[model samples]
Target: MVVKPDWLRVKAPQWERVGNVKDILRDLGLNTVCEEASCPNIGECFNAGTATFLIMGPACTRACPYCDIDFEKKPQALDPTEPSRLAEAVRRMKLNHVVITSVNRDDLADGGASQFVRCIEETRAVSPHTTIEVLIPDLCGNWEALEIILRSQPEVLNHNTETVPRLYRRTRPQGNYDRTLELLKRCREFAPWVYTKSGIMAGLGETDAEIRQVMQDLRGVDCDILTIGQYLQPSQKHLQVNDFVTPEQFAAWQAFGEEIGFLQVVSSPLTRSSYHAEQVRELMKLYPRQRV
Candidate 1:
């Protein structure tokens, strides 16, 4: 077993605020990636009243070995009331920004893209001021499905590459590196106004050169935001941690990303895709892009 480094330790968060956020999610019966994915920063994010809403699931269709979200259970039918309920959570929490992501719903023809659109529309209806970001799956290379979600124009569109191409067979067997890049490229082309983002996980036995190549690939697609974080093993059955990337290394990646033209780069041991994602609101102000 690999011992976790001191730099990876998370500060204890205020329980009162965390509990309040949990209560709302429970009351609304909404799923958050924070809980489902066993995110290291759950307490901090919940305490801050922010969550990446996991729509159309708590059950994923694909069983990615590194992920903690459930795949054994059968995926349930999409709930018609989910969008309004999620919007209600946004209204009650008074969040300045919200991230709506989902488990892979490959069983559906559109890979749950319609559900994402509904969530966006409902969120807009209830919390018009809350900027929205959608962290989506690749949709099995279904460009039409991609178009459905792009048309809604979430302030940011994020799809994680997860790891380098060489490790895709081992880490993300069902995912394709080319397909992932195409999705980001298509999102940029289809919705130029919507900021495109991608994330990469470190400590996956990937060399520094491999990580930089992935970052370069993302930049080639004009991805506006990039997040790089250390990957921790979710369980004994999951992939073992290859290494614990240090803060200094993360700083280097962030610097390189900025030098290469990423509008914003968040890299650290604990940086998850939606970790501190609300900062994009400020980025929007600094590098304002026209909303089509």
Candidate 2:
């Protein structure tokens, strides 16, 4: 493996703040994708008193090669208490914007969509002023399950495409490229009032033309927000990085996305699906057209 570029280096997290956030999550028995997935931006995001809550698991149903979240064939049963615990964390953290995501629970009947709805409702009951964003799975392409979560009325609904189509089989073996887009398309149709978001990781052996095509494809579905970032191999066992995308290239894509009519695009080496996600609230502020 090559040494990570200087641009990828992150300053160590301030321990005091990191501990505070961790204490809350631990005390509440809540999990965060930040720690579970080994996200590089954990330091900065957590210190700022925000987190993308990883509900429904520390385990997933699919073993995507590019992901660090653990995969389980027969995951444990859902915890009814999780929603209230997550709500308490949001209240204690005093967050105005919260991101809640979960692992694919294909083992369940509703694909765990009910848990998302419960979390949304619980958070609102406790902190009505706070905005909610849900990063969800494809639900094995179950549109009905998707609708269940959508009806909860989250401010932003996100589902990551993760990688370009051609890489789906090898990188995301259990994932279908078209199924992902179709989910986003249906989300737009189901809740046009909600801001729709998707994410893609570069350095996975995809070409510029392919990336641009993805940006175009996302716009074709009326996707409101896009996030592009470099893919760092989690361990020697995981897929190796193909290339390190340069800052200039990320800047170029950011501009290109705007040209294609994406309401907001966050592209950078360190950017993750929910990295600096609280700032998504600014989209409506900066671009009135995004007020949908």
Candidate 3:
């Protein structure tokens, strides 16, 4: 593993704010990807009174090698009450924009799309003013399941193409690069009014050319937002780090992505899918949501 650089270091968490956020989640029995995935920006996000909620189980059906989420043989039954609890958390936190993601629940027929719908409905019912964004799995290529979630009409529909195509087999064995692209394409076709966003992680042995190609492919599907971040290995058991991409390179990629017509591009070493997500609201102002 490559040595973690100083730039990757972050200030210690503001425990007072983190404690408050944790109390809300713990009190509501809600989960968050920031805690589950061990995101490096958890302190900053939580301290700012913002967090990406992780629904479903902490365990995932697809055990991607580079991910920190646990893999389970068979998970428990979906919690029907989770949606209400999550809504209550949003209400208590007083968040204007909330992000809800889930572990891949391939065990269910609809890949847990119904649960997502319920969450959206419940959140909207409780906090009608909040804008929702969902970062979802591919639903095992079930376009029907994808449609179910899209029908809920989140402000942003984010699905990460976590790494380059060449590393797909090793890093994300159950994931198909073509399928990922097709999912984004279908989102545009099925819900042209919704803003489609995708993210990628670097430093997993992919070339800059491959990264640019991925950007081009996303643009081909009319993906509106792009985020690029450097991948950090979670543990010794996980995939080893291949490189630490420089901040300068990340800025160059952001410039390139914007030049190619992306409405918003968040690219940096520390940038994650939901980093500074509140800023995405600006897109709504730039291109107000239109009925299709």
Best by lDDT: 1
- Write down the TM-score for model 1: 0.99
What's the lDDT for all of these models?
Answer: 0.95, 0.92, 0.92
Per-model root-mean-square deviation over C-alphas: 0.6, 1.7, 1.0
Write the residue-wise lDDT of candidate 3 on 105-180 in tens digits: 9889999999999999999999998999999998989999999999988888999999889999999999999999
lDDT of 1 by residue, 177-263 (tens): 999999999998888999999999999899999999999999999999999999999999999998889999999999999999999
Which whole-number lDDT from 0 to 100 does residue 15 have in model 1? 97
> Where is model 2 more than 4 Å wrong at Cα?
286-292
- Least accurate stretch of 10 residues (summed lDDT) in model 2? 283-292
How do the predictions measure up, each by TM-score?
0.99, 0.97, 0.98
lDDT of 2 by residue, 18-79 (tens): 99999999999999999999999999998898899998898899888888899954688999
Model 3: ten consecutive residues of lowest lDDT: 67-76
In model 3, the runs with Cα more than 4 Å from the true position are: none
User: Model 1: runs farther than 4 Å from truth?
Assistant: none
Cα displacement (angstroms), candidate 1, residue 282, comes to 0.6
Of candidate 1, the 10-residue stretch with the lowest lDDT total is 1-10
